[model samples]
Each structure stands twice: as structure tokens, then as C-alpha cells.
Target: MTKHRVRTVERYTRRTRWYHAAVYITVLALLGTGWWLLTGREGEPSPAARLTGAADVTLHTYAGWVLTGLTAVAITLGARAARTFVVESVRVDKGDLRWFIRWPVAVVTGRFSHHRGHFDPGQRVANLVLVTLLAALVASGVGLTMVVGGPGFVWLQRVHRWATYLITPVLAGHILIAAGLLPGYRGVARAMHLGGRLRVDTARRVWPGWLDRRLAEDDKQPARAEGDSPD
Candidate 1:
């Protein structure tokens, strides 16, 4: 295998990374619990069932609090940055037009070659949708949880149920796409664990101003006068 040396733009800061880690772990918790509940394992009085049942609900609630708190903090701390991420991921740019059109056909015809650097148009669109949908699901979920002691909390539960159900297919697609693009599940795992570096080409394409400026600065150095040059 050939290795390419490229500069990685810093896309995630420490705070951002921590927030994302919590959100992902919580999401996994929710999904695992929901799966068990749906499979009837959560209802049964078996050790695994009872354990997962209470654990999942407690986790699901606390996870909501953590995610919501982080989201609020993010918006407060970096409104412009958060807005930019949303817009960039959702906007279908010119480059994406061709990639989106060709990708499905290529996959169908067994010609789906993985490209390095940046999300293609289709992936961007899907990411945008997934983020938005999941955000809504989380919001609805937390809102529902709050009304537990009130009348019509059943309505809230129903909403949460539907939102939870909607994630199944989306989760599948998200997994499949990651699996296809990464070397293996481990590759995807590493990417998340490390807040994956953006490919140079992709980063340049997406944020030319930021990437190019840094690259140019790195490459350029002022020459010293002969008298002043280090001996």
C-alpha cells in the first residue's frame, strides 16, 4: 500500500471532540436499548433483559441531558462555526452534482471506487439529513421524557417511539456508507475515535481559504540578509 503525506486541517478542537464522543456513546446506548426493547429482551425478566432495561432508560435520559447541554454550549460558543458546518454539509455544490449522479450508477454497475478527501455531494446531503433528523429525534425524545408525570405523556412516548424507529434505516445506511468508504469497520472506528483527519485534497476543496493559507504559510519562509544569517 502506498502512503500519501498531506496536511490535515484542524477541524475538531478538544471541546468539540469531547462533545461528539459523548453524543456518539449516548446514541449507541439508545440504539442498543431500543433494539433490545423491540426484540422483547427488555420486557423479559432475565438478567440481561432487566439489566439492559433500566440501564438503557437511565442512560437514554442522561445522554439526552449531556447532548442537549453540549449542543447549547456549542451554539453559544461558536454560533458562526456551527452555522457554517450546517450550511457546508447541506449545500449541494457543483462538484457534488457529478459525483452524486455517477455514484449510484457506479455502485449498481460494480464500479464504486472510493475516493479520498472530503464528502461527495450525495454524502454531504445524506449527512445533512441525518444530522437534522437525529437532532429532531433527540429533541422530541427529551421533551417527551420531561412530561412523564403529566397527562398525555403517552403521546410523548409515542413520539419518541416513532423517532426511535426512524433511526433504524438511517443507521443502516450510515453504517453501510462508512463501511464502503473506510478500509474496514476498524478504519471507521479509528476515524471516529481520532476525529478523523480531513484529506488534504478534500479539505482544500471544502475550505480552500483555511487550508491554502495554512499550507502557504508552512511552505514560505523569509530569507535573512547575508550579515544576519545564522553562522
Candidate 2:
């Protein structure tokens, strides 16, 4: 079985890839450390409690800062691309709706629909929610620094907690997809490469509209150059 038939394309830049990996690591670390902090009730210190230690708050705080910093860096690195993605994500048509309808089946059967958008309809919706929730999470986290022991602090804590709870599952799904654990999305995980490439076929199927537009743009460049040449 020769797998060399798949052509490769640059789907993500190295810096973008790093941003993604850092975001994943930072969020998971924050979640793990923050979980016990959020859920544990008063009790005598157990081994697990001892494991968490007093610095847990500090760890979570710094992790939150790292998350914010990375988010900033990502935007700085790819402001144009990021803006394009956000703008394109607002578009939805019958194709996207069909993709969403078959999404669950794809998850179970490993046979994905040929989605033709910057993001599938489900992904666009999820992306919007996550962006909104993450912004709330960061805002509340920063606000916690400002109000330590007042009603404001209580409200901010709830905001932070609720946002964390909401994004946890989305984050889990993201991790699963990146790790190629999802059924139809197996090889699709390679798109998050740190200066790595993507299989052309996977790119075409998963991001057909994007791939097509990009290729069309590439084609135009050569023609434009020729047209500009002096005889």
C-alpha cells in the first residue's frame, strides 16, 4: 500500500502551529490544576491535595496569563490570515448544513462529507462559541486580579468557572482531532504541523472551498505576471 500518492501543501505556518500547540498545552494544564481548586471541598489535606500544594493558585494564574499571551502572539503573527478566517466563517449555505447533518455519522463511520468552507457549519458555530467563551474566561481571570474579596470577585469567579466548564469539552474535542483520534479526521490532524505539510486530498476534502480559492489565486498570479511582461 503506497501512501506516497498524497501531495502535500503548507496548511499552517510554523509560528501558527506553535501558537496552537502552546494554547492546547496551556489550557489543559490550567484545567487540570484548576479542577481540584474549583471542585474540592474543605477537608484535611490528602496526598492529592498535597500534590496540588499552595502554588496551585499561582500556577493557574500564570497559566492563564500564558494563554492570553499566546493568543496575542497568534493574532500578531497571522492577523491577516486570522481575520480572513473569521470573516469567512460567517458564511453558510446548503453545503454547510448538509455537512452538519452528516457530521455525527462521519464521526462514527469515518466517512466524512466533503465540506467546502473555511470551516464546516458545526465548526464555525463551535469556533464562535469558543472564541466568545475564551474571551470571557480571560477577561474574568484578569478581573480577578482587580477585585479580590468583593461582589465583583464573586461574579468574575463565576464567569471564569462557567466559561472553563463550557470550553472543557470543546477543548477535549480539539485535542482529539489534533491527535487524529477522531474517526474520519484521522489524517486531518496533520494540518496543525509545526512547519509541516498536509495531504492534498485531505485538504481538498476538509477545506475544499479554501483549497480551491487558494489554487485559483495561485493560477492568477502566473497569468498576471505574464500579462505584465514587456514584449
Candidate 3:
């Protein structure tokens, strides 16, 4: 029997994967504790609170702070990548509407329509919604911490709660897809986890345009290096 080599592509950088992990972990922490407090468990000590020796509110506040700090750092240090992410997320491709039309059936059939961008049409919508919701949550949370009792406080509280309510389902759907629960998205999680790579076939299927561009870039490297060599 002959051994065969499997080809793979790096879909995400290590820094990108680490940033994603940090953001999700912090967001989950905030959501868990915030919901616990909102659901009348304010004074009650859950297992996590007991383990950490902190109240639900304290944990939630600290998690929010961590998330805020992470966002600040990303915006400042990863400005270029952040700009690219926003631009890609908001860009409308010619066939985006058609892509969305096909996506529902394609989820089960594993026959996604070809799209031209870093994100699929569904992901573009998700990115915009998720970022907006997260920004609202962060802003409202910070305002809540500052304002004690007033109309401003009440307004911030409402924003925070509504943002949470909205983000929970959106985040859940994102998780379901990213977890590879959908047939067409199977093996997709490898792009953000497990060394941030995916089989070439998987990459090609899920991100044909991106994969083609990446391959083209790869093909130019050796020729460029050879041209730069001393004669």
C-alpha cells in the first residue's frame, strides 16, 4: 500500500486565531454571568462564582472589562487587519443575493454557490450584525458602569439587555455553523482551530475565490525571488 500526502492550506494566521479565541471566551463569560444576574441569580453563587470566589456581577464586570481591553488593543495594534475585516464584511458582491438564496439548501446539500470575497454572503451579514451588537454591548456596558441612577443609566441598561438578547441567537447560529454542524460547513472549524489550516479541497469548496488568490500569490513567490537574485 502506498502512503498518500494530504494537501492543506493555512486559512487563518496564528494571531487571528488567538484573537478570535480570546474574544469568544470573553464574550461567553460576559453572557453567562450577565444572564445569570438578569435571571434573578444576582446574589446566588453559581459553581463558577463559588470557584472564583466572586459574585456574578463582579465576574460579569471583569469579563466586560477584558473584552473592552481586547477590543481596544485589536483596534489599535491590528488596525490594518481590522480595516480589512470591516471592508470585507460590508462589501456587496454582484451575486450576493443569489448566494443567499442558495445557501439554505446548500447547507444540507454541500453545494454552496461560488462567491467572490473573503467572507460568504451569509458571513458578511453575520459579521456586520455581530460587530454592531458587540459594539452596542460594550458601549452600553461601559455606560452602565459609569452612570448610577438616571435616565442615562436606564437607557444604557435597556441597550445592554437588548443587545444581549439579540447577540445570543446570532452568536448561537455562528457557533452552530462554525462548529461544523452543517453539511456544507463540515471541516470549516479547522480554519480557526487545530493549527488554523484546512484540507485544500475543503478550502477550495468553502472559499474558492480566496483559495484561488492565495494559490496565485504562492505561485508568484519563486518567480519573484528568482528575478531578484544576483546575475
Report the CA-based lDDT of candidate 1 relative to the real structure: 0.57
For candidate 3, write residues 1-231 as lDDT tens digits: 845656676777899999999999999999999889889988789777999998888899999999999999879999999999999999998988888899999999878899989988899899999999999999999999999999999999999999999999999999999988999999999889877767778777878898888878777442122113222
TM, every model:
0.65, 0.80, 0.94
Better of 1 and 3 by TM-score: 3
Clashes of each: 0, 0, 0
* Candidate 3 regions with alpha-carbon error over 4 angstroms: 220-231
Instruction: Estimate the TM-score for candidate 1.
Output: 0.65
Tens-place lDDT digits, model 1, residues 1-231 = 845444444444556666667766767666776666656664444443466565555655666777677678668886886787777676645454555555665544433334332354555677777677677767777777667666567776676677677776787777675544532222333233344444454444434445555566656543222223222
Alpha-carbon RMSD to native, per candidate: 7.7, 6.7, 5.0
User: lDDT: which is higher, 2 or 3?
Assistant: 3
- lDDT of residue 160 for candidate 2: 92
- Measured with C-alpha atoms, the lDDT of residue 91 in candidate 1 is 60
Q: Which candidate gets the maximum TM-score versus the true structure?
A: 3
